[model samples]
Target: MNLFNANETKAQFILSLLPITLFFPIGIGYTGIVLFFVALLAGGQYRDKWQAIKDSPMFFPVMGLLTVTCCAGLLLERPDGFWKAFMHYQIYLVLLVFISVGAGYWQQRALRVFFAGAVLASTLLYLNAFQLLPDWSLFQNYRMYAGNKSILIGILLGIAGGWMLNQICANHGHKWLRISMWLYVAVALLFLAKTRTGSLIFVFGCALVLLRYLTFSWRSVLLVIGTVIILGVAWQTATGFRERLVGTVSDIKAFVDGGKVSADGIRLEMYRITTDIIKEHPVVGSGVGTWAIKYPERAQGLMSAEMATPHNDYLLYAAEIGAIGVCALLWIWLTQLFVAIKIGGENGMRLFTIGIAIMFGGLVNAILRDALFGIAFMILLAIPLAGISRHNYKSHFGDLDR
Candidate 1:
């Protein structure tokens, strides 16, 4: 037999529980270290995936340099403070880069596994709301949880929703099953207003994708209207669950103290502070870890301290480094995604479709919060980016199966 199997069993195994474990999820620390070694054994005994990682055109050395520059500057300004922020979180970022390189070897399957892990994590977390699972912390000490159970559920559903939608069109016989599952997911999602932005964005994106498949003849339009009316009528008559729905709305009202414009409606303030800070530290940046202390003026606008991260990733990069840094990071992320989309467009790889849908939510979520800075996102997202390089290296050898 040849060395590696047709399936990258080792890598798949590594990633299988990764979604739940990659972050500071409870039980992921030493356990991850053990699993990581197991991944090496599973990934094949001898080879390093380094060369494959270096080939990604979008892997921006400049952005890394920029981050280091900012971090270094922070150290120079105040070593005590800088060490706290950068010292703890940066390791996950580095680990992701390494794992993604391996992903390059077999890009599509690798992605499926990663997405599967993410979905599983979301599912288990949602179950916690119903007491089906325990609320053990992800990143035990590092609880940078972004969305609530319902919101996270919706986003994961959005992810699976796209896959299900693709299967509906691409496959036969399993159509009803996928549709039924999505219907349940949608109903569950409707109750998740705690994460209004995440839930709504996901639902909207899925709806847009599904709209493409609709048979929009007059009959179809009438059918759609009738369906909506029936759901509404049924919803009203079904008073059994009305209190639960009302409780959800009431909780949402309490959350939106400032008119529920989303994220406490301080994104504009974040934008203002980011712009002012950039103006002050134009060239090399105020450096990492310094923003929270140095920019208190910006954060504590009309109310108390606004937030730590600027929320928007583009802005956060700017805050960390400079315009050049932000641009470099965006360049790396977008260029790779664009190339991947093109390749998918030409070859009919469904991964391209799924990635874009997830990325849209990621992009929007990034606009509202700092998931990228979080431990789980760094490890999970970085590896995929690095994997693109392996893909490039494979391209040069005229090999299609990799």
Candidate 2:
């Protein structure tokens, strides 16, 4: 193959592989390597994508946040942490360029690639649950043990459920296959995964699908409400589900009452400590990658082990780069939600539902802290945004239209 053709083909192949990589930590690393090659092979396309990134509504806020964080990391004189923070900035830059340059090609293939990845993840997760599969050491670190696994699997299932609903509504896929995929995702999330957060998000996403596509018939509305009530009652009866529900209450009680050290109590104490530290450097903040350093001093006496930043991303950002950083991050998030809804067209509500779940889930859990989640979120977003921009450009600015 000619060098240019080889470059284009290889770049497309790597973009297709992205969705499957979301399932494994090793895959995440491999995906990055592949993306680097894709960028290098992209050549002249890089200039076009740079312009695309410039025109993207989300570009400024996201890049701005990254720049501010890097500056904070430098100001702290954290030679150790500066590189880590810089690396994150690099990840975003690479992803933005890759997505913008490849958007037109990937948009058509993204849905198929996404579903293919879901099937692979579901199969492996099922095998792992049944102990029928041998452990691959590379993916060993990605194991979804109780809480963490639930969150990750739950997020994937939620997205899958939305995809299933989209297919069913459009009547695009096989009827039986769509029904079965939704059933599997629901079963794995509720029965096998048994995560409260995941289950809630999945249900919320499904409800949006129903409300968005289904006509607002009074009978259907009542039936949906009745079904939800019955499900709520059933959820309460499940032993594991019940324990989580009750445990949340117990944790709150422990946090408030003068109870001994508990999981919830420790988290609350850590928040209190982090808050005090934020007050110390309220304006510019303690700087990125310095969480481990600042957290130890305040949380040392209160907890047995040093705590990480608060379990929350917003709080983490506020503590790291101060409220200004928080504002910038929020701007990017809100714009993403807005853009997802706008570009998503008929399925806009569905996009909003999933996007909000990811954002809210991050607030309560450490979802955004994981590099994999950040990468996955960008992939999910870039496909749609790229298509939207491309269509608009062709319609309004391209020679034929002009």
Report how far off residue 152 is in candidate 1 (Å).
4.9
lDDT of 1: 0.47
lDDT of each: 0.47, 0.61
TM-score of each: 0.64, 0.82
Model 2, which residues run further than 4 Å from truth? Answer: 1-9, 27-36, 39-43, 74-79, 89-91, 138-150, 170-173, 194-196, 218-238, 301-304, 344-347, 390-402
Give residue 35's lDDT in candidate 2 (0 to 100): 72
Residue-level lDDT of model 2, residues 203-305, one tens digit each, is 7777776676666777457546644764576476556756776777787777678676466446666666778878877878777766667777656666524
lDDT of 2 at 129: 74
Compared with the true structure, what per-residue lDDT tens digits does model 1 show for residues 186-253? Answer: 44444422344444444454554445445857744653464366346535653533544465465456
| Deviation (Å) of 213 in candidate 2 | 2.8
